[model samples]
Target: MGNFTKWLGAGLGFTLGGPIGAIIGYAIGSVIDSGVSVQEYKSEQDDYKRKTKKRPKVKSSTSGDFEISLLVLASIVIKSDGNIDQRELDFVRSHFIELYGKERANRAFKLFNGVIKNEVSTRQVCIQIREHMSHSSRLQLIHFLFGIAKADEVVTASEEEVIRKIAGYLYINDRDYGSIKAMFYNEADAAYKILEIEKDASIDEIKKAYRRMAKKFHPDRLQDIGEEHLNAAKEKFQSIQNAYEKLKEERNF
Candidate 1:
């Protein structure tokens, strides 16, 4: 009876102790699992950083930068006309802010201020644009710059000269340059020339002359010409239109 009691006690102890041991083992396994998961999370974070650490920088400079630079230069010229008016600065500032956002706009303003203060050379920058950009790009750039300069709704001859010089740097042909100038700067005179009429010509005379010249230079008639020459002719016709518009504006017709 004593032996049997001892055997039963040993069997009970083995069964209950085995379950307690299994619980302890499970707790330890859970702790190890959590530790591994934490290390993996950290390792993933490090890998992400490493992958992005050596990425290349983006270059978003389109023709916009050239436009921005010339606009700044124009601002300097216009401001040099006298005191840099708030209107002019705001016009330029708004343009920069619009193009490059607030951060780059601030930088552009600072750079322009430095130019005005004689801390940097705009001539060199202009040279870079001249060397790198195409003739059409320079024309478009100067046109926009002129727009900004005249945003005060008035353009000085000095400002005009600045644009002309910039165009020269960009290697724009003398003829094309003259054509653009005549279009914007002297549109009325150009129209009078095209129509072979006086500035104060009668309205009937202006109308008659416009009809004759329009018929002669119409783009459809010049279809035989190559695209390049056709483009030139088209520009001429546009100039005529611009001139006529200017004359009408002046006459309030």
Candidate 2:
């Protein structure tokens, strides 16, 4: 729990307030219930306050804010379909391990377990996120939620519906939402959708759309979020590339 405390102390900012803070406070209670001393936790909290007191507050979301938000939103999406699939749980755990290492991932999963058992107010949570997080970061969050929904190789309608609502609440526009959603589906027009273009788009139009989306979803947009999220952004970046390449091939451009 030392690492967990350190992470909470250092990697959080705006998330320590609002609805997110309320959720995290509950999770922290669960942590205390699990045997971590309240004194130790308070000490860490005091340390964090001291460290951050002199620093100017920035609107950008911190890595810990993004991480906790992911866990909370994931819990909502997992339960959206009315059953918790072990495969989705495994996907979330494995993805966290890959992003945060084994120890950190284990600690996060402990919090996730607490988060998953709660009833999340999705709109309220998303409104809070929209206020603090960047548009690119929110898009990445949607991408991750889709990955969870599709973990069983089938994205259920309920899951998709819930994700769409999340996207809307996060202020993701229709074209952007369609573009990201296209990454998880194999429909005939998926490539066009992924590029935010149309099937009937001319070669020049397609090229322009590809360039625009390439810039929009570039991995560097997430660099400040941490290497793990940057790597995930690369995956989304590659999907755009693949979609563009497919279009180029089909159009003989």
Candidate 3:
């Protein structure tokens, strides 16, 4: 298991760079096969599956599997505050059904229930997700997780904390997470509001507000505040970019 983890960590670093890395890792692992026929390997795998209490097949990508698992963990954290509400469940269900088939979506819910009952460490689960998924896909998966967390029209500090911690584990930097958070908070709406315009705001209004925020939060300008605040300023600048895009799309401006 230690060796496997080491290899998995290297594989994750490789995978973060590009698709070619993932392909190469798969090829290398396939070539280094431990002298077992495909049929024999399947038989042994099945035996291991039958013997182990954990879901054996989950480690493989059965399409949207990693994403579903993330949502499951996020739901567990969100519901830790109280009972899982119907609104929260419905939000999760809609996202899953869109990503995976209904059957798999239900399985995801059940699997999440089982995992939470066992008190699985979300960090470890996120590591598995990183192992099986590409960097971009993981970002999108985290976005969906945050979306569901905010879907009840509110985000508790606990839920936000869960999302932020998972984002860090997933290699989503503070900058990117801020963009995602802005998207959730309808900062696009704020952008339009800043411009005294709507989704149909003119290109001139868009440019004007962008220029104003850019100057206010630019890293160079924020340097006087210190490095920590400078870094935060960078993240805020990115949120401005996201907000502009959202409003631009909404207005086709």
Candidate 4:
């Protein structure tokens, strides 16, 4: 996360394509000077040319670009409540440090601050992320944004609106949105929605949802995302468990 000038281009494996790459170009390049050596990055200008001459590229399963997108998009949620709160900044910093370690986190913080100061289009960002990210990864990203919005311990009306907009633009399914939202908010029908079952669904149906969601969010199932996100997935796993427990208690199961 040092001066991205050295590692911002294809030479450094930042090949998250479409709107995401477009965003990186403007977000990191506008304020930072190019430090990429001519010898290494010289072919970057003809990126499209090379692609046409070569085989169709396969998207990387590596989480590198996903991690970068998290930092950049988290900043958007931070600024959603009208003003940035100190507690929110601390929360984001702690998550950053935990994931990237202190040195890289510091550099990421500097870059994130610069990013939020600009007028970023959330819809455009979502389009990019949706195109490049896997379904499970998108779920994780929304969960991360909710963590940021609740940093001050409460998500304001404005913040919920923004987060919902983000999920919508990401082409995220409505059921997925309901499931994730139920994890944090205490709405009366949250448990039912979290399971993605009808209020009048049979107990067997509820049980099916519980297992499906649990399997979907299990930490072991997410190992491919690398270690950094396993804990986040666990948080979601527990929430799904809790919702099922609530359903059982309500039904005297």
Encode model 2's per-residue lDDT on 132-238: one tens digit a residue: 89899999999999999999999999999999999999999999999999999999999999999877899999999989999999988877677778888889999
Model 1 C-alpha lDDT versus the unseen true structure: 0.51
User: Which pairs of residues have clashing backbones in candidate 2?
Assistant: none
Q: Rank the candidates by TM-score, best first.
A: 2, 4, 3, 1
- Model 2, residue 239: distance off in Å is 0.5
- Candidate number that wins on TM-score, 1 or 4: 4
User: Residue-wise lDDT of candidate 1 within 1-253, one digit each (tens)?
Assistant: 1121122122222111122222212222222223346554344334423333432332222333343445445654665456666777787778667655686566446435533443224455556555544454455455456655676767777777776776766676665565455555544377666455677798877778777756655656533222322444466567667667766777777
Pairs in clash, predicted candidate 4: none
How do all models score by TM-score? 0.46, 0.90, 0.52, 0.80
Candidate order (lDDT) = 2, 4, 3, 1
Error of 4 at 11 (Å): 11
Q: Report the Cα RMSD per candidate.
A: 27.0, 2.7, 13.6, 4.7
In order, candidate lDDTs are: 0.51, 0.86, 0.52, 0.72
Q: RMSD, model 3, all Cα superposed?
A: 13.6
Best by TM-score: 2
Single out the weakest 10-residue window by summed lDDT for candidate 2.
Answer: 48-57
Q: Which candidate tops lDDT?
A: 2
Candidate 4: tens digits of C-alpha lDDT, residues 96-197: 888767876776676576566677788887776676567788788898888888889899988888889999988888899989988888888889988888
**What lDDT does model 4 reach?**
0.72
Candidate 4: list runs displaced more than 4 Å. Answer: 1-18, 25-58
